[model samples]
Target: FRLAHISDVHLGPLPGVTYRELASKRVVGYVNWQRNRRRHMHDAVIDTIVADLKASQPDHLAVTGDLVNLALDGEIEMARHWLETLGSPDDVSVVP
Candidate 1:
């Protein structure tokens, strides 16, 4: 079976992150994403990646790392929608 592996996608265009939510180390990650990462990241990038991966017609796909930069509710929901396009849960692996 063919297997395609991708990691550290770091999907962004982050959600409405609040100061209260980032009252810890996440504050650092939030700041970094805003200054540096956001410029380099976009949802379309992930769409292109998924398109290419699908074109390859892999028997299985494995995705790793934090799909959302901030792990916000919106981001997690977005990740869920994106994951569906990759194929069924039986054919893809992201979270454990």
Candidate 2:
């Protein structure tokens, strides 16, 4: 059976904030990229990964934590969408 290992995708239309928001432009810039830019490399990467996963027809897929940037409440829905896309819980690892 084929198995796939995927981790830390951090897919987002709005990247999570950081403590350095008060100090780091890079961090803030990332948020802007995620929100305003409309298309990020990360988004493309995710599309490619999901497409590949579907095409590969892996028997199972493993998501090894940190799937999102900050695990914020708002991100849950997006995560669920991806999970649903991948397959059922039996096909992928359960969160809890």
Q: How close is candidate 2 to the true structure, as a TM-score?
A: 0.66
lDDT of 1 by residue, 1-96 (tens): 899988878877787877888987889889899899887778787778878988999999999887877787888898888788788999999852
CA shift of 56, model 2, Å: 1.5
Clashes of each: 0, 0
Q: After best superposition, candidate 2 residue 5: deviation in angstroms?
A: 1.3
lDDT of each: 0.83, 0.68
> Tens-digit lDDT track for model 2 on 49-82?
8788878889998877655554555566777787
Against the true structure, whose TM-score is highest? 1
Clashes of 1: 0
